[model samples]
Every structure is written in structure tokens, then in C-alpha cells.
Target chain A: MLISSAQGAVRAADTLITANWLDYLLIAIYFAFVLGIGFMARRQVSDSIDFFLSGRSLPAWVTGLAFISANLGAVEIMGMSATGAQMGLPTVHYFWVGAIPAMLFLGVVMMPFYYGSKVRSVPEFMLRRFGPGAHLVNSLSFALAQLLIAGVNLYLLASIVHALLGWPMWTALIVAAVIVLSYITLGGLSAAIYNEVLQFFVIVASLLPLTLIGLHRVGGYGGLKDKITAAAANNDKITPAKDQLESWPGLPLSGFDSPLLSVIGIVFGLGFVLSFGYWTTNFVEVQRAMASNSISAARKTPIIGAFPKMFVPFIVILPGMVAAVLVNEIVQLKASGGEAAIPGGASGDVKYNDALLLLMRDVLPNGLLGLAIAGLLAAFMAGMAANISAFNTVFSYDLWQTYVQKDKPDHYYLGIGRLATFAATVVAIFTATIAGKFGNIMDYLQTLFGFFNAPLFATFILGMFWKRMTATAGWMGLVAGTLSAIAVWSAGEFGKAFELSGQGLAFVAASTAFVVDIVVSVVVSLMTAPKPEGSLKGLVYSETPKEDLIDPHEASLPFFQRTVPLALIALAMVLVLNVIF
Target chain B: MSHTPERYDAEDARDDVREDVADAGTDTGSGRHTAGAFDIRNIIGALLSIYGLILTLASFVGDQSLDKTGGVRANLWTGLALLAAGLAFMAWAKAKPIVVPDHIPHDDDRPAGH
Candidate 1:
């Protein structure tokens, strides 16, 4: 599997797990298991409720794991690990600051609105609170985003398999989609969640070995730091002062790397506004919580998820650190005798996305390699299945039922949901196959995330806490905030083109959009007529009693109850990890 | 001039009563009401069993070569055990397909929905 170019520097074509009998065997069994879950769950899906929300019958444990698993996307794993390698340990802040606290906020505060509202989807909530304009805009944006996300995910999965297995792009895309489609169509959301939990375990079990072995070989965590630092420091192509290998910035921004991006940007832009926006408002993630059988269970969902979510960086990020050393060594060796380095391949520079694979190639033997690869494949499929489930639910409830055909039979909507799933899968697969034509779509979509999410969060904050927020205000605020975000982004791009210091434009876009949304919403709410107190009964905080929002049973429990305690534990672990690194 | 306002509480109450009555009368065939929409055991078991079976099958038919499995039968052994475990789950589900009694406790006490 060695790929030697004309320059004679050998690059490993097979990323890892030299593809033997047991590897294929493990993978095949996993596929069969995924299908079995789907088929077995089919009969239980008697109505659209079953298809979408598992009839809201799932327990906290089931919902929690699935909740985390959905966000623990396979596509993002490579990106996270890559960030780990490039930006150093500050990347973990993306989880600790950006995710953990936000998840808790959603669980403790926001779930009351989502689960208590009895709304089938996020857009439905918007329709109730704001109006049709906000509802339509959000539903359309999310629906389109899911499809593009699914398509890109499929393409990403296909490309990886093509590179590793030498299978055609279509083979990988079709096989993965078919496996995902089989169970989703058969069992619906329950099957999807069950499989997601299964994928989470499979991926964790497979990759933990990579981290353990990598650390063992490098002596320990301290050893790894020393080795990687030395290698990075000596590499002639890029002069890396020892500080470059550091987790905390020793200069200026002592808590985080100032040169990379500020702690303010990370904490405020990402942690507060953007994180809350995505975690709370986006139904894709909240769908897991919304499936819990009781309000109590629903509230526990995200907190339960946070425990495992905090620990993920150990497996994903550590491998990147290990690769940093291996990469430095490879670069030094390639350049030692004036020999040609293969640029982005094995002998030249570390491919951040391929950090995990590069680690496998460097150390693991046959059996473990195969398992790790299988785990990765499972994770990718899990993410795809999650998106598909969310997409189908949102499409059917928000778009199809409300607009197209009203008050149809239960089975009629169920049928439509299944059809939507199939259609979405096909569209994604096709998009993956033709992904090369519109390769830059991924970058555009990333920028568009802030535009859609940041402004939306501002509206939600006003709508939830402020009783004076009129429906008209909701619509206007959303429109104005979104436009401001777009304008900010355009200005950033324009500045970048003109060679201006467009540093941290992403953060700038988000913070500015959020501020504008808040100001506009407040002013508009004050100017416009507010909804009468009686009409706003269950929706607004002023009208809804304290009991409905906070469960009596949960409230009566000790401070050491599962909700706050789990969050504290997660925060503790993140702090420990940050300090040790 | 005077104005009047109306709320949907009474109508919602009526819908609740009708929904309850319909649920009670849902035993369409002959005798009993089974699991309501969600069959947790069957669903979980099915996933577990399938997962188990695949592992077992892979163990038997999987390839062996250098830079691969090193002829380890952990995959096969693990799969067979999982398959058996899965079947056991299915058997448990069949034995106890949750009856879901007609009058669920505290049913009238909670809010109907958002």
C-alpha cells in the first residue's frame, strides 16, 4: 500500500489497518447490526409520532447517549483532531467553553420551552411564539442546511473510504447511505437513536486503543509533550519556538493563545452566543431531548450527555498530539540530505484531517487497526443517520404537514416522512458523487452558520425572557439581525480581498449580529404592541408559573442531584485537563 | 361599546376526554392493549442481536492477511456471544410485552401538552 512518487519518497496509500479478513468481517457484522436495528423497529412506527419523536417515550439514558452521539459527528472528528494538531490544546475550549456550559443552559433552562411547548419541531415553536415569517425563515434555512450538511458528510465519508480501501467513491457513498436508510425507514427515530448509541460505543472502543498505545510509546503525556516540542522546535522549514508547542499562551493572553484567536472571541462569540444558538435553538440537537418520555427526563438529557462529551477530546485530540511528533520526525528525515519532501503526503507535512489515520499507520498492528477503522466508519454513518432523522422530522412537521396538506391521517404523514427520508438520502448521495464541482460550498456553508444561528439566538433570548416581545418584533428582529450578519460577513470578505487585517472575522460576525439582534428586538418590542398577558399564558415566562418551567420533583431534590452535579463534574474535568496540558 | 374574549380551555378539555376514551377503546382486535407505540425491549433487543450476529458471522468468514487481523478470532468469538445475548433479549421481550394498563397512574394530573 506504499505510494512512491517519482521523487522516491514513499507515502502510505492505505491509511491504516492493512485490510485483511477480520477487518472486513468486523465491518460487515456492524453493518448487519445497523440494518437489524432498523428492520426490527419497523412495526412500532405506527404513526408519525413514532417516526419522528419515538412517540416521546424514550428514557433519559437512551436519549442522553443519542444526544451526545448526534453532536459527536464523524465528520467533525477529523476536524477536531486537526485543530488539536494545528492550534494546540486551546481547541478543547470548543468543547468546554463552547459546548458544556451551553448544553447545561439548554437542559436546565431551555428544555422547558421545547418539551413543555409540545411543539413537534423548533419551527413550530417559532410559529407559536413569533409568527409565520420567523417560522418559515428558520424552517427553510435549517432544511436546506441539513441537506447540504448530509451531502457534504456523504462526500467526506466516500472520499476517506476511497483513499483507504481504494473503493470507488460511489461504492462508499451508496453502501453507507443504504445502511443508514434501511434502519431509518424501518424503525424511524428510535432505530436511529439506538444505532447512534451503538455507534458511539463502537467508535469509542475502537479508537481508545490508538490513544493508549500512542501515549505508551511516547512514554507518557509528559513524555509526549517533551518529544513533540523538541521535534517541532528543530524542524528547519518552520521555526517553532518552544512556545509554539504550548497549550497556554505564555505571552500576553496567558490563559489562551492570543496570536491564534482571543479567549474573549472563544468564550463570548463561540461559548455564549453561537454555542447557545446551536445547542438551544437548533432542533437537530434538541430533537434528542424532545424525545424523552417526561419533562423530568427531557431536562436530564443534555446533562447526562455532557459527562461523556467532556471526555471525547482524550481519544480524538491526543492522537493529533502524537501525530505532531511523528509529523515533525517525518519532515526532518525527508529534509535531512537535501531530499525532496512529498508536500502534503506522509514524508512532507502532517495532514490535519488525516491525523488519526497517520497515527494508525505509525503504530497499531492489524487487529486493532481494523477495529479503529470500523469505529470511524460507524461514527460517520451515525452522524449521517442523525442528520437524516432530524431532516425528515423538520421537513414533515414544519413544511409538508403545515403548508402542503393539513389535518391528514396519522399514517398519511408517516408515509410522507419515510418518502422524505428516501428522497433526502438519494439527494445526499448524488451530491456526494458530484461534490468536486462545488467544492467550496463547505466554506460558504461554514460562514453561513453564523449568519443563520447567531441572529436567531438573539430573537429566541428576547422571546423567551421578555414578555413584551411582540410577534411583529420577533419577525423584524430576526430579519434585521440576519441582514446585519450578512453585511458583516461581506465586509470581512471585502477587507480580506483588500489585504486588510480581517483577523477573527467569524467572531466579529457573530458578536455584531447578536448585538444588533438584541438592540432591534428590544426597541421593536417597546415600540410595538405586546401580546396580552392572558393570550401569552404558557409561552412566556411572566405568564407561565415557576413550576412548569422547573420540575417540582427535580427542584425538590438535593443540590447533588443529577442535573447540576453532572455539569459540575464536566466543568471540573475540563479544568483538570486544561491545567494538566 | 364592549368587547368579549374566548379561550380554548373547554375545547381542549373535551379533546382530552375524547382522546382518553379513544385510547381506552383502542383494543380493536379482541381483548387487550399492548405497548403504546414504543416497544423499548423489542427495539433495543433487535439492535443488540443484530450487532451480535454480524460480529459472529464476520469471525467465521473474515479475511486473514499481513497488516490485518493477525488471525485473531476475537471478532468471531465476540460476535457469537453477542448473537446469543441478543436472542435472550428478544426472548425476554416476547415473554413480557409490556401490557400498558388502561388507566395509567397520575394521567389526569399532568398538563396535556404544549
Candidate 2:
């Protein structure tokens, strides 16, 4: 038995080790193609706004597509797929419940405020509403946030690339960084977004076909059903744990111990938090929306984006559950190489990360495998481009230009922007090593992300709606929010380390900060005098859309409001399947 | 007809010639074209696509039942749903033409005859 086990391991190692010059050639070809896109985009680069904002030239659809593509990096794909492998179907509740609608609302509601106000950066809004002091604080915090974020993205992409191809870890990291930096430096936002558009296609084409092929190999849907049903017969992890069937973080739930509560919590808590935060305030997301050619175009983009967002689980997550069904079949047969040899969480949950990768290796034919690798690279590239670009924009425009050089030439600032992009890439690499040390870095990464963003989201939101929110109030609220989230995270207060699939604690902290910032900023702004009239009016409101001064009517949004309900229906369908199986 | 910078074919032809000659030598303007590198339409389509794909993938994770006789029906249904949604989007954008704005207004204003 020992000899046989060793032989199996040896064969697997050999298969991985034998990635040849062909593979390297393929990788090089991909890099060359991506760099070619960058070189093509160079002629478009101009002054600051064009570099940072794509010169605000994007129409609604382009903004929406680029926005979604920017965030769908290798990290999110691997991270979310890993979650599905561990947690099951309810995991998607994050995108369906929280993120989709928030993005839609951002487009239809908040975008006009930003676009109409003509603010160059998210921080610029805070500065105009409050003062230069608020701008300084927001800008500094955002720059730090992007710096940390750049590191996390690099780590996620590197891990996947190293695991699949036997590329040295740093090789993957540097290659990934270089690909993104080349385009961003040359073409700026335009190049980044354009490449992101291409990456988006390659990724979906790769993942979708592989998912279908896996389903076929597993004896189609019925075979998948039989396998999952058999597993559920033996294991409880296939269903919600008794304790987890409880409550959402903020919204009411049936008391804990109710069998349905865990499912509901899974649907809302895990699903809502992850999706909402990404959609609402993340710069990569907002930058896409802000690039719309017109306010009306911006508003329509998210609604269009959301219509398709309702279907995430069917493609990315279900494949894992299907893999779960085949776990025993694959293990017993001990099929030659690839996913068939490993089972879920058998070695550790890290194998769960290997689930999708393993599936592609075992099932896909050679040419198709090349396509899959290309798709994975696309995911990595799209995300890397977004992160580096966001870091560059914030550093050059928000940090260096604002702080380091008060009055510089347009060309000089552009040069600084390029330099900042390179420096940010280096800093991100160092932080990635720190990221590797954490056992489950998702929650910590998220909470830290929230620490920077929670305060900022609150200040941005308040600055738009409320006239009186002073700069001091915005700054104080921001500081208060970050401090509160950190205090909550450090005390082991949320119970399990990976509670609610790793996002519940961070969500609670961020939501708390958002609320507190609003209450404090509003009260203080009222107590203090309003900003001196027209001085700040141009920063916050737009007159052409008469709806700007007041809260836009929350009338019956038959299509808009139903997104959550539609999500719930989809969730119900999944739950019904789990029950039957 | 309304005298809003109206130009007859002969006059417009002469004017075009004059403008071509007028703009021949300026380094800043020479050989420079305004066509942008990026197409917001494609980027937005791609972004919406990825998010849509994620959501679609999520919906399939839970348990569902299909006719035993209809082999691969469920997977097919799910794939069809995703492909339909994804492709429909790409197709719709292709059908609807994009209209680029003629110019972006600049914030800094210089004296009229610099």
C-alpha cells in the first residue's frame, strides 16, 4: 500500500515537472501579445486626467464591462472558488444579495453625484465638501489602502500561477507585474481597461467550457446529482451546520439553532458582505463607473451589469460541488494524474484551492489546457492591471502630486505617475510575503481593506447627501471608523477565525464604521456652520439634473428592486437541490 | 438655410484647402489624431460580463434536480443560461452603435487670442 501511494505521488510529480519548452513558449507568446497591446496603447497617453481617468471618455457599457473585469482577477476567481469548495452553494449569496444591487444603485444613484460634480478622484469629493484637511487625510488613507491591496492581488495571482505551471514563484510574480505595468505605464487607464476587456473574454471562455466538460465527465447533471446525494447521505458538511443556521450580521434572522438560519445567514451574511463591499466603494469598481462619458450613461451601466451578475453560482461554484460528488469515485479509481487523485479538505482546505486547478488538469485535453492556462493568465492580468492602475492613480494624483510637488508641469506629474506605478509594484511584492504568513489571509486582508475604506466610504457618502458635513467631521469620522474596525478584529470578537466563509467579521466592522461616520459627520456638520455656499456647491451637487439637490425618488423600481428577490429565487433553487440530493 | 455658419460646396471645398494649409507646420498638432486607444464599450461589456459570470456560477452551487432521462440537461440548462446571458450582452453592444463625444471641455481657460 505504501509503495502504491508513493508511486501515485511520483507520477503526479512527474506530470507537473515535465512542463516543457512548449509551455514556456506558450507563456512567452501570451506575454508578447499582452505587451503588444500596451505598445499599441502608448500613443493614447496624454496629460494627468487622461492617464488616470481614461480622459472620462468611456461610454456606459465600456465602463460597466471594464469595472467588472477589473475586479475578476485570479485572486477573486481562486478565492471565491475556494470558498465554494469549502462552503457550498449559499456562498454566492455575497454577489447576488449584496454586490449586484449596490453596483446598480451606485450607477443609477451615486454616479451622477460623482460625475456631475466633476471630481477627479474619490478623495477630491471629500476635500471639496470638508476642506483641504479632509482631502489630505482621505488621500493618504486611500494610498495606503491601494498599496496593501496591490500586495494581496499579486500574492493571489502568484500562488495560482506557481501551482499550475512550475514557474518559480518570483518569476510568476514579476512576469505578472511586468505585464500589468507595461500596459498601464504606456497606455495608462485606457490601456488597462482595454486589456481588461480582452482578459475578461479569455477568462470566461476558458472557465465556462471547462465547467461544462467537467459536468460531462461526472456523468452530466444527473451523475453529479447522484454523487452529491450519496455524499450528503454520509456527510453533514454538504448541508448547513446546526449552529450556522442563525442570523445575518445586521438584518434579523430566525434565532440561532433554527436549521434554516444557517442557510439564510449563508445567503445573506457571507454573500451580501463580500459582494456589497466590492461593488460599492472599491476604487477599482468605482473608477470604472466614474469613467462613463455621461451621467445618464453611468447610471445605466450597473443595471446592465447586474442583469448577468445574478448567475454566478451556476458556473464557478457548482462545479466544486460537482467535484465533491465525484470525490469518492475519483479517489477509489485513483485515476491517472490530475484532480481525480485528490479529495476535498482531505489533506487540508488548501486542496480546496486545488480543486478547480486539479479539475482542469485532469479533464481538459492538451490544446484546451493551453486555453485554460491562457484564461487563468487573463484573470491574473485583468486584476493586476486594475490594482496597479488604481495604485498609480492614487499615488501620483492623490499622494505625490498633492503632497510632494504642489506645482509641477503636466509632463513632470506624468513621469511621477509612472514612477509611482513601479514603486507600488515593489512595495506590493514585499507585502505579499507578509500575506503568505497568515493562515487564512482572506478575512485579515478584507478587514484591513475595510479599515482603510470603511471610514472613506462613510465620508464620501455623507459628503454627497449632507451639505453640512464639515471636513473635520469627515476626517474624525474616518479615523474613528478605522480604529473601531481594528479594535473589533484584534479581540477575537467574531468567534470562528473563518466565520461566515471569512467575511462576516469584516462586514460587521465596516458597516459599523459606515453608520457611525454618518451619524457623527451629520451631527457635527449641523452643529458647525455649512461650507461657504458656492465654494463647495460645485463639488457636491449638479444642477442640470434637477433631481440632484434632493434624494432621488426611491419609487417602485420593478426591475431594480427585484434583483435581490431574483437572487433569492436562485438561492432557493440551489437549496432545493441540496435538500433533494 | 438658417445662416448658422452655412457653407456652400464650393466655399466649403476652398475652406478645407485653406485649413489644410493653415495647420501644416505646428509640431503639437502635426500627425496627431484624436481617436482614443480605448473603447469604453468593450471594457464595460467585459466588466459586466465577468460579474455576470460570477453570479451565474454561484447560482448553480446549490442542489437541483432534473429528469434522470435527460442526461446533461441540468448542466446544459445552466451553461445555456450563462452563455445566453454572456453572448447576448456582447451581441447587444455590437448591435447598438457607440457615439463618441466630439470634444471634452477643458477647465483652464486662456485669453481669447493667445
Q: lDDT for each of the candidates?
A: 0.67, 0.57
Let me know the DockQ for model 2. Answer: 0.06
lDDT of 2 by residue, A94-141 (tens): 555555656765665566666666666677666557777777877777
Local accuracy of candidate 1 as per-residue lDDT tens digits, A337-441: 213343443212334556667677666554445667777777777778888899999899889887898777778888889999999999889766554344233
Question: What would the TM-scores of all predictions be?
Answer: 0.80, 0.74
State the lDDT at A517 in candidate 2. 69
Q: How many angstroms is residue A275 displaced in model 2 relative to the true structure, after the best TM-score fit?
A: 5.0
Cα deviation of A382, candidate 2, in Å: 1.6
| Model 1 chain A worst lDDT run, 10 consecutive residues | A248-257
Tell me, by TM-score, which candidate is best.
Answer: 1
Weakest lDDT window of 10 consecutive positions for candidate 2 chain A: A246-255
Cand 1, B chain, TM: 0.54
Model 2, residue A490: what's the lDDT? 58
